[model samples]
Target: MPSDVSRSSARPGGSATDLAAVWAVFTDMYEAYLAGDRARIDAHLDPEATVWDSATPQLLLGKPALDQVRAQRPAAERAGGGPVEAGLTAYDQVIDVFGELAVCRHWLRIDYRDRPSGLLRNTAVLRRAHGGWLITHLHEDGQAAD
Candidate 1:
């Protein structure tokens, strides 16, 4: 039911250009998080989107919910005793575009305190909203395979 050309265009790694915008925004988000820039994170994330892939698996929906996440950053930092230094080891991202909807799968290796030596793979789905993109849903799993 689909033409070959269409199929080709829809492939995950179809064209580098096709994924540039989303990837840039996603990268920006990651940088903001790393820098502990709550304002920047809030600015990019949709008010109604949900962040589901945390250790607590939070369902952060609506502006208030997102703001709560922003608020929790400092508290979490305090709880953890200090700032976390994380470095990405591997990132294999796949972006699927369907008009204004996009889904991204990011396999990342994060260095955190609890598991300072293992890699965790996180998958996040984003959507285009209000002239920008926002993370709509996320699911992360800790992997020992690394």
Candidate 2:
């Protein structure tokens, strides 16, 4: 978990731990994103998953497409010379589990080091595999900050 991010109470399957586990997958991904660690992010993604990223112009069909975007990051960002991400906050989190599948929805606010903060509404679908969770689908849309 990122020490800069605060975790909110989870709502899922009547088990806080289940939500905790699911939350970990995302927190881990967020940490990887901040570090520009593509491999770590890939580990949590399902091979056939889809992503509708907040800044992308079109839907990203799978891990390959996601990787392509990661590869296009600015050298300044990859080298840690850009504005830092002060922290991330999630609000109105909701998670529901059905058998081995789970769905999560939350609104995220990212506080940047020297830029205007950004907000995104996100949703994710996850499946249980190898005793862990993998994201099968993710959608993020930029939102106006309040």
Candidate 3:
């Protein structure tokens, strides 16, 4: 909800705990995207962040690139409508935290427009910055749904 991520006691210690913490941040970022809250999304991303998605061949690097992509999208898609629904069901999630850096790998099921559009294999790299974890790099490959 807020730009800042909240930590819970339920998330305990060790890799699992760390993973949960990072996952919370990730979900928050995703929610911001869905809500079209550019400020909130910016808060969760590093200035040098890069992302690759199935729809694009060019790597999206930096906030300007992200903005351009968003501007190119249809207003309805950006604003959200038409029975649109998306979910990220992550499996085989692995998070490795080293000092201030963390890498997460997971298989994700992405449902779009109320249908199972695709399965995505994702790897995200985060860095502890600006008082919280911010996504620095994200790579995704979309595959045919089962």
Candidate 4:
């Protein structure tokens, strides 16, 4: 069984709608994070996905890494907390709608803890496989203030 119930496959379809569905998954992940819903965030992301940041000194790989991060949250604040709030400054996204191969570039400004208070740009590539869209790779590099 998957570590969390939310991580289980929620949808099963391979069509044009998958594009929007997959994108919704990404968006939901962000929203869930801001809401301090760690299970929801993990559910939306692939188990093999990697998280990285240009400013951070390490790369977080797979659900285990993400789970570890979530585990650090205090029990009282794990579900919903003021610190979970983040302002999304910008979202410049580009999506290539190929039948099987797609790439999405999301430029964002996040206010997570222990991070600078500026924009942090990121890119993600997704592939349609096994009747679903899976995030194959992602890279995020921070930009210092001018």
What's model 3's lDDT at 131? 55
The lDDT of each candidate is 0.61, 0.80, 0.71, 0.60
Q: Candidate 4, residue 119: CA error in Å? A: 0.9
Order of candidate numbers by lDDT, starting with the best: 2, 3, 1, 4
User: Which has the better lDDT: candidate 1, or candidate 4?
Assistant: 1
Best by lDDT: 2
Model 1 residue 121 distance off true place after TM-score fit, in angstroms: 2.7
Clashing pairs in 1: none
lDDT score for candidate 3 against the true structure: 0.71
Point out the higher-scoring one by TM-score: 2 or 3. 2
Per-residue lDDT of model 2, residues 1-146, tens digit only: 33221344444453666677777788778878767687898899999899998868878999889878866878787678777898877666677877688888878889998999989999999999999889999999898887
Q: What is the number of residue pairs that collide in model 1?
A: 0
Candidate 3 residue 101 C-alpha distance from true site, Å: 0.9
lDDT of 1 by residue, 44-138 (tens): 66666666645546666667775666566667564656646565443566678777777766655666655565556666667777766777766
Predictions: Cα RMSD each:
6.7, 3.1, 5.3, 8.9
TM-score of 3: 0.75
Model 3 CA lDDT for position 109: 68
Predicted model with the maximum TM-score: 2
- In TM-score terms, candidate 4 sits at 0.62
